[model samples]
Each structure stands twice: as structure tokens, then as C-alpha cells.
Target: MNTIDEQLWDYIDGNLDAAQASIIKEKIDTDAEVKNQYEELLRFNLTFDKIELEEPSMSFTRNVMESVAIVPAPVAMKTQVDKKIIYSIGGFFIISLLALFGYVLYNSNLTMPGFDQKINFNFNLDKYITPTTVYSFLFADLVIGLIFLDRFLRDKIVQSKKI
Candidate 1:
């Protein structure tokens, strides 16, 4: 009556005492909903009882483990480039940067006029440009060009070596 509870299932499963089971049986007989729920639970229990556990053949597990062990583990390609070679290349760039910064600080000739020098403002870009600056620009461009060419040639040589 007061809505079917777990005690009803316990009764259906024969987990309850005779007295409790009798009480549930009386309620199930009187209540349509309780009767339907009990019957459904009974069918489910019967179906579950009919089901059997299946065991795989003994070799099934052994075969699976063997297959997994047979799978090759990935490996990293050992590089020909030495650690010292990489460090030297990085050190060279660092030294070059430091030298450039040192040169700029040494020759900057920055005078803080502070509005006293009466700086003449000129829009003429040609007067500000110098041969040394142009050559420096060309030198930097050439260095970059050489680095790219080296990379391209190195890649081609490596690829050819592979073949």
C-alpha cells in the first residue's frame, strides 16, 4: 500500500522473513501497481538466473598478452649533430648580439640637448642616410641569405644521403 519499497523486492527475492513476505504478499495481492512491480522484478530475477557467465579459452589471454609484447616500441632517431656543435652555434649568435649592442652604445653619440640645441627638423630622408648604414644593411641581408642557402643545401644533402 504506501508505494512499493525495497522490502517488497527483498520479499520477492526470498531475502525477507516469512512474516515480512506474507505482509508483502497481502499488499501485492491487494494493490495492482505493487503486483505489477513484483511480477516485473520476478521476471528480471528469472532472466538473470538463466544467464550464465562465459569463460574465454586459456590461450585467449596468453595470445593477447603475447601480441601486445610483440608490438615494437617506438624509438627516437639518433642525431649526427654533436651537442658541442649546437652549443657553439648558439654561443656564436650570443657573442655577435653582444658585440653589436656594445658597438651601438660606444658610438651612439647621443646628446640630450633638452631643447637647448634647437634641433633642426628635416623631412629629407636622403640627408639622414649614410653609406656605412647602407653597407651594414647589405651585410646583414647577405648573412641572412647565406644562412638560408646553407639550410637549403644541408636539407638537400641530408635527403640525398637518405636515398
Candidate 2:
């Protein structure tokens, strides 16, 4: 019942559909409360329309704008690089690698220093596995985790600034 005024206000603002609006209009014409609300809204709207917005002083604008000093737009964390330059560098490296690989393949003749027969790779895990190696792997993972955390925090800070 109390919210009927809000609905009437919406109707006055033309936010209601044509059919609903017409119905509300009929209510405003026939119902005392609705008509009273409509009149009040009209008066308030007219008053609001007549009111003038205060303009900021020229010095205020000048001071604020001057304080805001011109800065270059924010760039991506991963700087934009020319794709052509990257591709050319990659192409050069790849071509060099391919040439070297081809040369090696063509010139290669396998010979062991002391082996009488061909060496077969029967890779035994027990021969290479050690406690220090496990600790080293754990340490490496921790450093990687720290780096990931730093990057994540930095990104979050940048995102917060954007918002």
C-alpha cells in the first residue's frame, strides 16, 4: 500500500509499459491517494527542473587539472613487441639450429673411447636418485611458488588501481 506511491512515481517518470501506465493513469484520475501522489511528484519534478547546478570556479578547475599532470597511458605487464622482429629472430635461430643439426647429422660417426661394443641405455633410477636431489627439487618449487605469488600480488594491485 505504501509502495503504491513509488509505482506512481515510476508511472510519472514514464518507466511503466503503455498498458500498465494507462492503468496507473486511470488510478491517478479515480483514486484520491494516487492523484495526490501524482500531483506531489509533478510539483517536485517541476521544482527540480527549475533548479540550477552550481558551476565550479575556474581556479578550482585549473588547480585540479594542473595537479593531475599528464601521464602516458598504462601499458600491458608484458610489453607489446613487434611480431615481425620476434619472428625474424626466431626464424634466424631456427634456421641456424637446423643447419647445425643437418651438418652434425651428415658428419657424425659414433665411436666410444674404450667400449668394444655398442652402449645400450638401460637407465636405472636407483643410480641417480638421492635425498639431496629431492631437497633441491623442493627448494626449486618453493622459489617458483614465491615468484608466482609476487606476480599474482602485482597483478592484483594493478587490477585494483584499474577499478
In terms of lDDT, the best-performing candidate is 2
lDDT of 2 by residue, 62-140 (tens): 7887777675667769977999999999999999999999999889986658776878889997777789888999999
Candidate 2 lDDT at 4 equals 84
Instruction: Give candidate 1 regions above 4 Å deviation.
Output: 1-31, 74-100, 103-163
| Model 2 per-residue lDDT at 46 | 88
Clashes of 1: 0
Instruction: Please report the TM-score between candidate 1 and the true structure.
Output: 0.34
Q: Model 2: C-alpha RMSD to truth? A: 22.9
Q: TM-score per candidate, in order?
A: 0.34, 0.37
C-alpha local distance difference test of each model:
0.87, 0.88
Lowest lDDT block of 10, candidate 1:
1-10
| Model 2 C-alpha lDDT versus the unseen true structure | 0.88
- Residue pairs in clash, model 1: none
Clashes per candidate (backbone, < 3 Å): 0, 0
